[model samples]
Each structure stands twice: as C-alpha cells, then as structure tokens.
Target: MATTTNSTVVANTSAPTQYPFLGLPYDIFHELCLYLAPKELLVLYRTNKTLYNLLKSADGKTGVDGKHLWKRVWQNSPDSAFPPCPPWMTEPQFVALCYDDYCQRCLRPNLLGAGQIWTARVRYCPECIKTQFTPRNPLEDFPKGPYLNEFINEPHLCVPITPLRVALGDRELVRDHFHTPDVARLCRAIIDASAGAGGATDLNEKRSSVMQQWRSQMTQCHEHAKLCHIWQKQRARRIRKQRLLAKRYRRENILSRVNALGYKQDVSCLGHRYQALQGPILAVFDKIDALTDDVIAPQVIAFFDERRTLREWYWHRLIIGVRLGYLTKALDEYRQAAPDELLPHPVDIATDPMLRPLFTLPMSANVPYPIFQGLLPEWIQTWRKRRDDLLLSMLTDDAPSLWSCMDSKSHKSHSSRSVTRSSASHPEGPAAIFQHFYCTSCENLISSAAATTHTCCYTFVENWRAEAWHAPKTDGKFPTTTSDILDSACAREFQGITGWSSSCLRPCAAVISDILITLGLNTKFNWSDVGKIEGMHLRCASCCADKTLLVMGWRRAVVHAFQEHQGVHLCWVSVPPAVSYKAQLVEHARHKLTKEETAKRTSWKCHHCRLPRAMDAYTKSRMDIHMRFTHCIFHPQQGRDYYAAPEGVQFLHPTILIAATELRSENLDAVFPEGEMFRNEKRVGFLSRVYVTNMS
Candidate 1:
C-alpha cells in the first residue's frame, strides 16, 4: 500500500525526479541503502517518492523481498538503541518508533519516548492523553436503576477504570473526546451492535462475557503502561550514564595528549574547544600521510614554540597591513594615480601617520618580522578559508571520514563482498552511520553516533551542567544576585557559606580545568599547567562543620582542635566571587599609586631646556610642568624615587618627551638643548650691551 501510495505521488507530479541516488543500478542502490542506519533509512524513505517506490517495491529489481530487505537493514544497523520488536509490529513500524520522539497526535516531542497506549495503539504525552480521553463511569453511562447500578458496580467490574475506546464505522479511530451522553450512547450502540457476533441464545451471558473481556483487556493495558513507564526511566538513566562515561573518556584523551606534549591548557586546547582545530589538523595529517596523534602532537608543540614571537609580529603586521591596505586614504589615492603595472610596495605603510607607531622598521626588524612579513599577504588571503570549510562541512554533514586510519581495503570492499555473499551474515563496521541533530537550547549539533540521548533530553542535561556557573531561571526570569539565588529553598538548605545548591559546588580544580567546557568562556591563559581557580573564598575542611573561616590560616586552629579534642579533617570548599577579581586587582593597584606616591622626587633634568640648578632636578610634577611649557611635550610619570642625585643632573630613563625632542631635532636638522639655549643666546647678547661696556 505504501509503495502504491509512493508511485501515485510520483505519477501526480509533473516535474522530473530530483532524488539523486535513484539513478544507480538496483544492486548498487540496494548496497548503498544497506549502509544507512535504521533512523537514516527512515529519513531516506520519507525524502521523495522515486526512492520510496524503489525501496518498497515487492521483490525489488534485485529479486529481494522489500520486507526482508528492511529487516536485514535494521539488523545490520550499529545503533543498539531499539528493543526487540513486539510480535504485532513490523520492521517499518519499529524503525519509526526508534527514530524520532514527536508525539503521534500533537506532533511535538513532549513525551521523550513514544509510550503507546496498548489497546488503542496510539502514543501521547500526559497532557495529550487528558485531551484525547473521556472518562467512563459505569454508574453514569448506563440507565439509572438499582439493578443496573448494582451491575455497574459489581465485584467483577471492580477493575481500574480505563478511557473509552472510540471506534467509528469501518473501524476508523476517532481521537477527539466527547461529552458523557454522546460517548455513552455511542459506546452502547457499538456494544449492542456487536452482540449478534457472539451468537449466544441468552442476552445476559453475552453481555457478561463482553464486559469481562473489556475489563480484562483494560487491566492488562494499565499494567503495561506502568511497566513501560518504569522501563523508560531505566533506559534513560542507563543511556545518560553511558554518555557521561564517553564524554569523560574523550575529555581524558584530549587532556592526556596535551600533557604528553607539555602544552599549555588554553581555551583552544580544552574540552570541546579542540573541535575547532580538529578538521584543520586532520587535513594536515592526511596531507603528510602520518598518524593523527604522532604528527599533530609535534606539529602543535613546534608551532607554538616558533610562533611565540612570530605571532606578535603577525598581529602587528596584520594591523599595519589592514590600516595601510584599506583604512588609509593614501591607498585609495595610490590606486587612482599609479599605473597598472606599478603597484605600491608594502614598505610604503610607514608613510601613514596613523600607522607609524606600529610600522617603525628599526624597532621590530627581527628575524621573525621579515618571515612573518613575507607570509603576511598570502596568510591574510586564506586566514578565513579553513574556518569556512569547517562550517560548510558541518552544514552539509558529508565531511570526509576520519576513519581512514583503519585498514583501507576493509573499509571499502569488506562490506560489499559480505553483502554479495550473504547480506544476512554481513558484519557491522566500527563506524556507524550517524546524522547530526541541532539542539536550539544548547546550540550544539549533537551526532547520533556519539550519544544515545534524545536531543530534547540531552539539552536539559547540558543546561544542568551549565548551572555550576550560570544562575538558573525561575519562572522564566534569572536571579540577578547571589542573595536572590540564596532566597530559594535549595539554597537555604545548603550548609556551605556560598549558600548555593549542592550541584553548583563542584571541586574548583575540576571546573577551572575545563575552563570553557561548562560556561563556554572565551578566556585564554598563558600558563603551562592547570591553574587554580583564584580569588575565591575557601572553607577549611577541618573547621567547616563547626565554624567557617574565610582565611587559610584558620587551619592551625582546626589542627589544634583535631589533635586535642576530636572530629576534623582537611577538605576545602572554594567559592567563586560575585565580583571579578581582575577588576579588583586593577582598582587596588590604581589606589596605591594615587594615594601613596603619585609625585616622585627626581634628579632627571629636562633635556629639552637649560634651567637654573634650583629649578632643575625637581619633583616629577615640576619636571612635567617644565617639559609642557618648554618643549610642548608631556613627560612620562613614575613612582617615588629610591635615591637622590645631585641637583641639575640626570638618570637615563627613556623619556617620551626626550624622544619626541630628538625626533624633532633630526627632522629640523638642528640640535636640541642648544635650540633652547639659542633662545637664551639672543637674550644674553642684549644683556651684554646693557650691563657691560664693549670696548671693541
């Protein structure tokens, strides 16, 4: 019937077939279909009619029964998520149940697993169940008489009440619920309509037997619902544990690689972060034809070591290049004025005033700079190409397989040969056919191969993991403060000083080690080891039960208490600060500079001017004023001087005022200090005429 429906659907469309894979020969087409998992096959089946007709045709072009093909395909699928198919269900129905979580009636994933109500064979969530079912009270349904009421409430009828099954003419199921009178009348009509089918001579016996069967069926269904509920919980828990174990294993493997290479634990190398680098590195590995770990480990270590200074140069070059290449008006002018063959050299970037500070040649003319400069143009062109490739691969999901490390011969030909010999005895491969499902809540494209969780349930677990850093929402609004969170019942019950739920109280090391794993922070560290989570309040393990102290020194008292009296052990509870510690450190440094020592007494004479001895070797504030007036320059300020020097002398500090003065001198082709003295030179000539008689 499905095949016929598919054929009719294709025949109705005037447009040509758009299905890509149906062009293959029947043997090849069937072989390709065998590679898809049950879930993927279901997607393939629903995609279009041509493929559907091909898959569903009786004893297909290859002379294989379609039903048997489906069974074999399901049997070969590597995902063991499905249970044994019930005796009443076919392979197609079982595949449908395994693949998706959307409720049959509501068309939403409200109930994770489709808990099919047994007698009706319809799956629904709790809310949908309530909406679809009409309660049937025996007393209310039948006529109002003592005999009828007694019969309705009889000991034989004492089973748990089930919802009325609404079957219309021709056995068509009706999903909508109706009021008592309409429902009771319809149910009575159906029961009475079926009385003749039993063919009993007496009316009571037939009615009694029918009621008995109805009660028995309802009781079995109610028991089955209970069992299904329990089974779903157990399955969900088992799958969750397996997922956590797999995640932990993957995390450990990445960490071990990082440790082996003695690499720093930066945001790029930590949990889930390595995904960004995975494709690029794998491509490189394939190009070199080397093992992934062996090539990648050394390459990363060498790259970081060589690029330490080179990276800084690249950043500088990038800034200079972009500013000169695009942002500057000079580039546009050059483009307009210059001939086609005579392009501007990159060395001309020094001419732009806005770029001069960064483009100074002599200051940064190291070995790395020249190398970085040579590579800059090409690198800039392709900087975003790899990232774009990864994005496209993720979207298309036809990414090149990373499983090429296995025996190459086996991967391509083993399955084909096995299928040709006997499709039934074909073995599954190490790699499973997986499809990516996007989770909107967590923004993770989860692969079905990596986990067995429903995308909906997995999202909640991800949200729970994030609760360590992120304050959870209550009634759609997130609490803005720690105090607001503490007002909740869970927080109030916590014995720790932070007063947060126990779920948030993970070991600081574990949380800080993952760094971006939980909160997905963009922070990067330069350290070579897993750094401690600093700027947090620590609770002493020994003293916390009796008293809480904010300082680590209180451990002495805990030790004394333990030795002298009883009960104590060394454990610590590290609490994250509400305010940023980095901000606090900056503020503290600023305060110390401003309050204690902003003006320092100095012997560094202003090189821009020749001042009187008493006025020279002045305080930092006076020198700044002297420079501002004499040279039109602002002097660089510093803290208090350690030692005093003679008046009108200098200590060699690289003063910005002096460098500017020197640069001005070089540009003007004249000497400074003398330039200031040249101003005094004219005054002294006039003073000699007034104060002394020149005999000559």
Candidate 2:
C-alpha cells in the first residue's frame, strides 16, 4: 500500500483467518460483513453473539442517517478481485481499506486517485486479506501496491500507520498526510492525536460550519435539478421516437410483399387481391380459392363479374374486420415477425378503387393518433431526420468531411498561421491577432502572424471564436475575432458539433469525411495489428438500419449500409478487442511474398531459352534482357505483338510489393517513426508497380 504510516498489519498470516467486528449498524453490519475480503467476515461474525445475532436479520436499517458512512466502508473493503479474507482489523486498518473504494472510472489513477494518505486504516476483504493492494491487476492502471512477491519476503505483517496509540485531530492528520496542515480550507477544528499534537476539540464549531456549507451545496443542487430533469426527459423522448420509427419500418415491411402481389399477373395471387377485402368478401375469395373442381362455389365467380361493386364490398368487409379486432392477432404477429415501417405503407392501397371499401372502416377513439387514425406529420418529420442522419453516416462522408474541412488550409488551418508580421520592433497588424489566442487546455499562447489554427489547444474552437477575447474587426462584414456565442445568441446562427453524441460523423469523422469523400467507395476500414494493437483510433459507436450501434471499428459495413437505408440508433455487440486489421493485411502480404521467395529458390528453369538459370537473379529485368537480347525466337509477324518476334516471358506473383513498402518505411522512420507508417494494402500495390519498372 502506498502510505507513510508503518503500524497497521501489512499482511495476513499463513493461517486463513476471519474478521473481528466490535460495533456496527445492523443494516450496514450485514452489508459490510458480506463485503469483508472473504473468510474475515465469517470470522468477525463468529467473534460474539451480540454482533452475530444482530447481523442475522435480512430486512434491517441503521436507525440514524449515517450520511454515506457505511457505503464508504463497504466500498473500501477489499476489491472484488483477490481471493482471500482478513482477520480482525483495527480502526486504522478499517480506514485504510475505505480509502481505496468508490473510484470506478478514469483511464489511469493519478496522485489524487489514491486517497490512502488521509486515512488511517487499510481496508481488506476476507479473502487474501494481506494489505488490500492490487499488483498488475487488469483494469488497474495505477501504481497501486507492489505485487505480493515484490512487497516483502516471508509473509511479514507490519502495522500500516505511524507508531501511535491514539487518534489525531483533522488538521494534524491532514498535515501528516499531505505534509501540510492546511489540507482543506478550514482550520481550528480537530487534530491528529499522534504523539506530537492534535486531539478531537472544537467539534461543535466545525460541525456547524460543515452543516452550513452542505446546506448551501444542497440548495445549488436543487436549482440545477430542474434543468437536469428537463434534459433527461428530452433524451428519453428522442430515444422513444427512434424506437417508434424502427417499429413502424418493421410493421410497414410485413404487408409490403402481400400488397406487391396485387401486381402479380397470376390469377392465384390470394394475399394481395384479398388483403383489403372485408370479412364476407374475404371469406368468399378464400372459399373460391380453396375449393377443388369437385365442388365449385357459384356465388364467388358471379360476384367477381360485377367487379366495381364487388371490389368495394370486399374492401369494406376487410377494413371492418381489421377495425373490429378480427385482424389484431395477425397484425401483432406481423409486428413480431417484421414490423409496419419495414413494410410498405398501408396508404398504397388507399387510392385503389378495388381497395376503397377498406377506407370505410370506423376509427377507434381511444388510440393516441385517433384524430389522424394513423401516423401524424410530426412523427413523419422525426422519422425522416433520423433516417437522413443515418443515410448521411452510411453513404456520404459528411462526418469525416467536417474534420477534413477544419484541417485544410482553405477552411481553417492555414488561416491561423497567416499572422505574418515579420518584425519584432514594430510588428505588423497580423501579429496582434496572435496575442489573444492561447490554448485553454494547456494555457499555451500562440505566436505567429500567419497562425490561423490553434495548435495543441484547439478544442472547442467555435466556443472560443464566440467569446469576447476573439475581438472582431470594425468592418460591418466583420473580420476574424472572438465573440461569445451566448452574448450574441440572437445575432449568430449556431450548430453544435457534439462529436460525443453524433453517431454518423463521430464514428467515421476522419476516414469517411477525409478519405472516403475524396475516393468514394474505396473508403472504408483499414486496420492492422502486427504490433501495438492497443494504439488505434476507434469509433465509440455507430448508427445502422434505423438504430444506433455501439461497435469498435470505424468502418462497420452492416452499420453503414443499414444507416444508409434506415435512420435510427440501436445497441450491438462490440467488435472483438485486439484484432488488428492493419497487422492482418501486412502479415498476409509478407506470408505471400515469403512463399514466392521460397518457390523461386527451389524452382529454377528458363523454359523459353531451354536452359537452366538462377531463379534468385531471374527478376523481370534480368529475364527480359536475357530473353530478347541473348536468345530470340523466330517471328511470324513483325509488329508490336509478341508473336511478331518477342520470344516469351514468364509470370510472377505480385508479392514483391510487400518488400518495397517495408524498405520505404525503414527510411521514413527517422522522421515519423511509427506514426507516418499507418497504411493500407494499396500502398504495397503502388510500390510494387515502381519496383517492377525499376528492376525490369
């Protein structure tokens, strides 16, 4: 454990031990008991009947509101990993374990993440109850504790805290921890009860101040809660809208094929012709279609002769049946199998005179869209927007283009560097433009009259531009300057990039918008994992076929294809981690080249010259030179054609390209190292073309 103290037990003994609890709330006691490292909780329970009996109750509560005290203790208990428990622990041991709990997120733990110094106890679960330190644990990126093997030899146990017999006041503990008495803003309260100074004093005064501060913080939370609630509700509504669209597509697809059969030339198209017919007419068609030559239904054909009136009757009958819940089960099944929106719209049958009877079906008053009796205008708009964004993400490189545009000199990059003043004693006007621009993240001020784009600190560019610090020129047209978007909200037309939220552009922001837009269908995923598979830029999620999908690769074919087809968001299984696309391509190419090299080394025969030659030197150039100059065959014709005099040539696998790219990279590595080396297989093809010509 990373700590300054040296008094608490550092490791559990070889004998698997149990916990020893003195006092605890019933509800918390039960939870904490279970949270103990492992066997330690059982040991604690067996210590005495008073604590053991109290823990037996299932539905229990700590009578007083402890203000997250028990929760803290439970979290601090040894991590879920590590399989061993601790024995009875002192107050310092308890406090130490509590310090490591509650941290769930953050790529790596920094100085602030390990809160062990302020605590006195080291928390451990019953299982593997040595100091609850993780060594090389997956997902733990912090310098936690030295592994068991590296910590100390022979299963030793040392108290984790300083040598002390008493507790310390707040300030003294803080001083002991952070090496500063002013750990927090407050002073003159309790202190560390170590041998030097500090004891629990003026508790009442500190409590009052803390209470006031807590009240103020609670009030602030109350004020912001309303906005948070509104935003959350809006998000829910948006998600619901997307779901309805997906459902609509599913429903629509169900009856589409059934309806398409109306155009079927075969007289036996039952589903399409009878789809809109009401119950009686539907039954008549069903009976006519069902009966054999043995027993013909006379009424069926007679009614079909009076086409106009008969079709109207059929339509009305079918509509009435559907409206009266007769078809409810069928429609439900349709939803289950496919869905309405996926099928063609029911409106396709509305204009058909044969289907006119279906329009007569009465509407129910209770349904949400009872007024329209179907989808409304607003629903249509919502569906269209999602669908469009999906299509944009799939087909168009709009997402990637945004970043590309921002990167290009024509858009934003070169303009930032246009601040060329050229003189220090008396700089030009352009140099002054660089004065206000500084990176907010790193606090680095940019210098360069020609500098247009901010380097190393260009996040949230629009927000910076909208601020006052970016003062605009006096011209009415307005020169480059920052103006707070909030201040000039009414005057400026704004759109948030919101990369974290956008499905289409966010996933393929660079590749789709940059490479695909420039190259069309050629743009897609290109990855390799020969080495350092962990170092690749990946899309957090994607939008596909009326749903948003969370995946790993930026180029998700199904997602992009479906998003182009339908607009929506959905969840999906992520791509398997550690599979490197780039590495796969490189390895495959190398394997192919190695095979060709092996084959050439084994097989050497100049069949055209009717003589044996070294395959190693049988390159295109060497072979071609030897074929035409040294040994030429008799010709029948005299033109550019091979039969006109060219003796012969041999074919070779295009595997040599792999070697050329490998060679180019080693040379370029001096400047770019591994960065400029990121590439796809096409580079190999281009390099092979050059190598072929040069060697020939």
Candidate 3:
C-alpha cells in the first residue's frame, strides 16, 4: 500500500516538471523575455501566473526593467511619430495615458477627444468635467481663494467629490468630500503654527510664498495643454490644405486632358456636357481620369453612366465614403485580372462588402464592365514610360546649348571682374558707381558690375541687375527717383502706368509715403524736396512674386521696403532668381542637364533608338556617337506634336526653343541693353555728383 502511494506521488511531480520553458535558468529566461515585444510580453503575463510573477518587480510596483522596455517598444512603434512625451512625464505614465482612452470617472467611452490631465494624473470626459467634478468653494477650501483659482485654470483637474490634502505648517490635514472636522482642525493648526513662527506678519509672507509656487506649477500645466491643442489644430489644418490642393490639381488635369482629346464636337459636346458634373461627382471623375493615361473612351464612359455610377447622388457618397488607398488597390486588382474575364468595375470595387466603410445598396451583378480594363493599364504604363523617357531625352540632347549659354563671353560675365578693381580704387568717382554690394546671407560683396555676371547664390538678391537704372518713363515725362516719389506735391501727380494690370503696377507715391518715416535716409540730402531726380532700379534681396512690384532706389530704400510695408522678409519662390530673363533661362537649362547627367551616371541608357537601349560600354564618347548617328536623323517639330510620335522618332521639348530665344534676344542687345550708356546715361552721373543739369 505504501509503495503504490509513493509511485502515484512521483508521477504527479513528474507531470508538473514537463514544462521545459519554466525550468530554464534565470539568465536564459531573462534573455528570452528580452526578445519578446511589449505586446507579446503582455500576452505571456496574462497566460500564466509564473510569467506574471517573473515579470513583476521586487518592489511590487512595475515590471522588471519596465521603463527601458516600454520606452524601447514605443520608440520603434508608429505611435511615437509625433507629439513626443513631455520631458516632465515618465515613460510608464505616458504609455498608460496613451492606452487609457476611456473616462475613469464614468467608465463610459469618451465621445469627444477627452484628454488626460497630467498634473493630477487622471482622465475625464467633457461631460464628467461639468457633471461629476464638484467645485469646492475657494474661501472654505484652502484658508483663502488660492486653491480655487488653481483648480479653475487647471484643464486636467476633472475629479469631483474627491479628498484634498492641504499643508498646514508642520501638520498635514486631509479634508473629505463632506468637509468634516478635519477642515476645522487644518485651520486651527495653520493659525497656531503661524503665531508660533513670528506672529501674523511672518505667517502672511510664508503663506503667500507657498501659494505663489503652487500658482506657478498650475500655470505651467495650463500652458502645456494650450500649446499641445494649438499644435494639434495646426497639424490638422496642414493635412486638410494638402488634400484640397491635390484634389484641385487632379480636377484641373482631367479638364486639360478632355480638351486635348478633341472630343468637343460643338457647343453641346463633351466640354459643355461635362460642365453639368459639378460638386462631389466632378471630384470622382477627376480622380478616375487622373489614374488613366488619357480621357476614358466614350464606350467606357457610357458603361459607367448606364449603371448610375456617373450620377450625382451615387458617386458623391461613394467618393466621400471610400479611402484613396482602397480605390488604388482595387484598380490594381482590375489591372492584373485576366483579359478574357470581366473584372468588377471601379464602382463595384468601391462598394465591396469588405472594403465598404458604410452600408449601401448592392450594385447590380449584371452591371456592364469596361472592356478596356486589361488593355488600359498596359497602355497607361507604356504612355508614362514614354513620357518620362522623352522628358529625359530633351534634357540630354540640349546639353551643348545649355553649356554654351553658361560659358558665353557676354559683357554681363566680364563686366563684374573688369570693373571690381576700378570701382574700389575710385570709390568717389564715376567708376565707384559700380561699388561692390554685400549679400546679407552669404556676406560676400558682389560688385555692381559683377552682379550681372555672378552665379546666383540664391541667398543674395534674386533678380540681380548690373546697375539700378532710372525707373522707366510712363507718359514721356515723370519724376524718376525715390526722392521725387516721396514728395508731397509730386506724389499727387503720380498715377500708375497705363496698359498694365494694377497688380503689376505699383502706386510708387503711396508706398514711399508709408515707408518714408522709417527710412532714416541721408542726413545731407532732403530727398522729399529733390525734383526730377534719377535713382537706380534695384531688386529686393528677399522679395518674391513679381506682382509685388519691388523697384527700389539705393540700398536704403530696399532696406526700408524689407523692414516695413507688409514685409515678410523672405524669398519663398521655388525657382531661384537670376540677373535677367536670359540668366534664368540659362540656369533652368543647366539644372535640367545636371539632373539628367546624374541619372545617366547611375544607369547609362541610349533613349535615341527606336527601342530604347541601355549602353553596355557606358562611355560618354559612345553615347555621343550613338546620339549623332541615331537622334540627328529626326527633324525638329514645333509645339507638343513631338509628344505624339512615341516610338518612331524624337521631337524636341518646347522648353529648349524657349530658352534659346531668351539667350538670343539678350545677345541682340535690342531686348536688354548691354551697358548703362543709353542717351539718359550720358547725363546721369554718380550718387555724389547728382545735379539738376545732369538730369537733362
């Protein structure tokens, strides 16, 4: 009987020992735990009491190495993308708050974005803040109204009918929800302690100091919450703006394609007919059209229209209901489907049971599908590849012309180097008129003569001019200088230039008057009194949008304009500015060539041939030889007719001719004069030599 009992006991002990994981050495077990993610660890903790106890800290507060583990997990997660935990918050507290979305007070889900109040370390919904948070009277609460104001301003303090702990000199008193005898004891303790310290005089100062510190802490909490709210609002606004811009671009692209396709037969054609599709349905059409290579075929459009997908009410809700990602994925599925099989149409895809966010009436199974689904995707891919190749070819083929422009021996390039030394030596003479001008950003002085030749630093004045020429005469006679513009009597006679839009033509008189007080110009010259004076036409260093009409007279006027008069003092244009239209064209060409060259260096390909061939040799000389033999055969065609011949031959992109024309015009000297030696210039002298006789 004793031997049978011993065998049964041994079997039971052996059964418990079957778990190998639990029997692992302590070091090995810890190493294994380290590999598991926070979520996996949480799962393991819930699975068994052994794992829970192993993870628990000796202090009985947090899991072992909880801070480091939770922090590492959060850092690697997408949730840590923005709004990082404030430095004042602990890792555990932040993780807890992030996961705890429900209101603690009511235990119901917070419908609004109810946030946590970190100061008191609690969460509350908006409803609970007003209903559950019982406001304590200030006079009765903290011996005065200090605690009341703190509580009122604190956005986080939502707990109502809660116990309060107050410091009363050396004694600590806890006041209950019902305001029991503890409150009275707190008041007596404070009074007694204050009297013992040094009488009422010292007591008032000590109380005031403690109240001040508490107020400061509460103020910090309020500011933190306010800043966070503002950041969230701004982020949301930026996302909304980007989406709107993308939608507008898509709509404009569709309209452009519709016009290009020549579908408009007459007044009642596609162009006029599409005008009826306004509002949300118009947006859907835009998105659909943008996805395809061109305007969808008339047959495909008819197929969609028959099913009421083109109808206003149906498409409107579908567009608003479906996400962009789901629509793209559905389109991809259609593209990959068998050519013989009839794939579900885009409208049907949108309303799929699994994909649908909102319940809707089922689309008819007999709905006509687009015949071109399999063919259209392949065509679209081909068209895109051809378009990109053409763009790249245009950049590559025009490399020599672009380089020639940069290497030109024009007077603009030589003028700066030639005149720099002369200007410095004769600072007070005629040569001094070309004195060096320094950039505020780069701090490099570009001589007036060199300004035309200089490569744009992008930080200096965007539109650099050789010299500030006199403002052009509008009606054959008008005062030309800043001094003339600001004159009280002369200002009245100044009307804007004719034939130009008001946006382009500045009312110079009004602008100067507004800026004159802030100018702090020369102590010697009475600029307002000077008549029929000549001033240089200079550009602003930071001005963008040519519509602003930024023509200024010396450095001082430019400085004043930058400081005052709706001045953001920023050059925000995407394209860098140049000295002249010619310079800008040259720079644009150079930039395009550089971009293409960089791409070619990575993967050399011969795009000139009928079948685009990647060169095996990958030599510049080989590329040149291939281009001369192959691409030179094609004749240049005007406009975008070049885009039509996708495979047969290459046509030059229109931008090439546009750039050449600008450079040619500058060379002719008829467009922009090479020097300031015009009939007006023979009379106009240096700034120091200004006189009435010189104006004639």
Cα-based RMSD of the predictions, in order? Answer: 37.5, 36.0, 31.8
Q: Whole-model Cα lDDT per candidate?
A: 0.37, 0.30, 0.35
Instruction: Report the Cα lDDT for residue 488, model 2.
Output: 28
What is residue 439's positional error in candidate 3, in angstroms?
86
Q: Which ten residues in a row have the lowest lDDT in candidate 3?
A: 687-696
lDDT of 1: 0.37
On TM-score, the candidate that comes out on top is 1
lDDT of 2 by residue, 134-165 (tens): 22221122122322223223211111221222
Please give, for residues 1-696, the per-residue lDDT of candidate 1 as tens digits: 232223323332443343355464444455566677777877877788765765676544434356645765666554344444454466566567645677777787854566555434456676677765664443455433333334464422423333444557768553434233323543584368445644433554555554556557556655555654554566678767776676556545544565676544332322243332344443432342223453345665554454334333333333443333332244334445543422222322232233344443433444344444454444323423432343334423322221112222222322222112222221122121123323333222234321221122211122322232221121111222232221121121211112101121111111121121111221233332113332222333333322222222111222222332232222333322421222233234345443433245444554432111211345656766766776667644443221232321111110110111223333432322322111112322111111100110
Model 2 TM-score on a 0 to 1 scale: 0.15
Model 3 lDDT tens row, 366-394: 21224233344553454345434433343
Ranking by TM-score: 1, 3, 2
Model 3 — TM-score against the truth? Answer: 0.24
Q: How high a TM-score does candidate 1 get?
A: 0.28
Clashing pairs in 1: 541-571
Q: Which candidate, 2 or 3, has the higher TM-score?
A: 3
TM-score of every candidate relative to the true structure: 0.28, 0.15, 0.24
Superposition error at 44 for model 3 (Å): 6.5
